[model samples]
Target: MPRTALFVEIPGVLIAAWAPDLLLPNVGIALRRLRQRNVPVIAVTDHPPVEADEFPDFTERLQRAILEVGGELAGVYAALPDKPASWRKPRPGMLLAAARELEIDLPTSWLVGTDNADAHAAAQAGLAGVVLVEGVDPPTEELGIVVATARDLCDAPRVMIPRQGGCWHDHPQR
Candidate 1:
């Protein structure tokens, strides 16, 4: 089975991990690209059991860590959900809600996550693209196009949002 990976901009840092100790090799490239573009990145995560204000600090720290880890960030939303709703992975609620709140174009935005839940959520919301990383089961060929492997998501071709009007692809198409 395919390895399970987690590609998430969490409250503590921009992280990408594969099951059983796998990690993204090209994470540096992705971070550099994100910084170069100056795009706003938010971590739409399952709310921690901590106080509300604590997340802001966590978000800031995570942003710093992403930079330390070679990630660029314009900002972070770090929104929390009360239950398993659209804001959670596989539902597209979190991505869609974040995009709307951030005033970003859905098609221009990309969701890089490890599980099929993330891909499903990205697709459900009609985002520009979704990249599934290691750990998730191999899609039965019913999901949208596979943009890249976990190690090469940032270096792969970027999906552009024509309706919004901008070039997002910084590398060759996969």
Candidate 2:
């Protein structure tokens, strides 16, 4: 049987801001709970090649930063801008790669992101559902379907069922 995994986004989802307190409290709770459940949470991000501040090594560093905040990650993956659409957010490429390399079942996985791009990517990848952190209200017409919504990162774990998968909430609200 193929195992289910949790695919998480970095910037907005994990570290909401770049400051001394980068990780949100609920975000840490979500990561720690998922870790306790033995769910493989792989952090994914896009590498803006033109950005002198961002690089290939940022993913690993982001993972370490998350760990310091009580979020233990299984691994981290990145998609370069120069790569195919599948490699970037709003597309399933990066998620697909992580699923393939990690041996995860797309139809049984979950994604915790802050925008519809994350939701779209999960839907495109055929993931069971998604937990979109509240605050950013992207156009619904532009999004596929937001399986679930979290007021903050902390609500993610409550919405996702690691073993049997999770339920779907078509209507997303703050």
Best candidate according to lDDT: 2
What TM-score number comes out for model 2? 0.76
Q: Which portions of model 1 show Cα errors greater than 4 Å? A: 1-13, 16-29, 47-54, 68-70, 77-84, 144-148, 152-174
What digit string (tens of lDDT, one per residue) describes model 2 on residues 87-166? Answer: 87778888888887878777767888877777788888988778877566644663343467767767775666533433
Worst 10 residues of 2 by lDDT: 165-174
Question: TM-scores of the models, in the given order?
Answer: 0.63, 0.76
**lDDT of the candidates, in the order given:** 0.51, 0.68
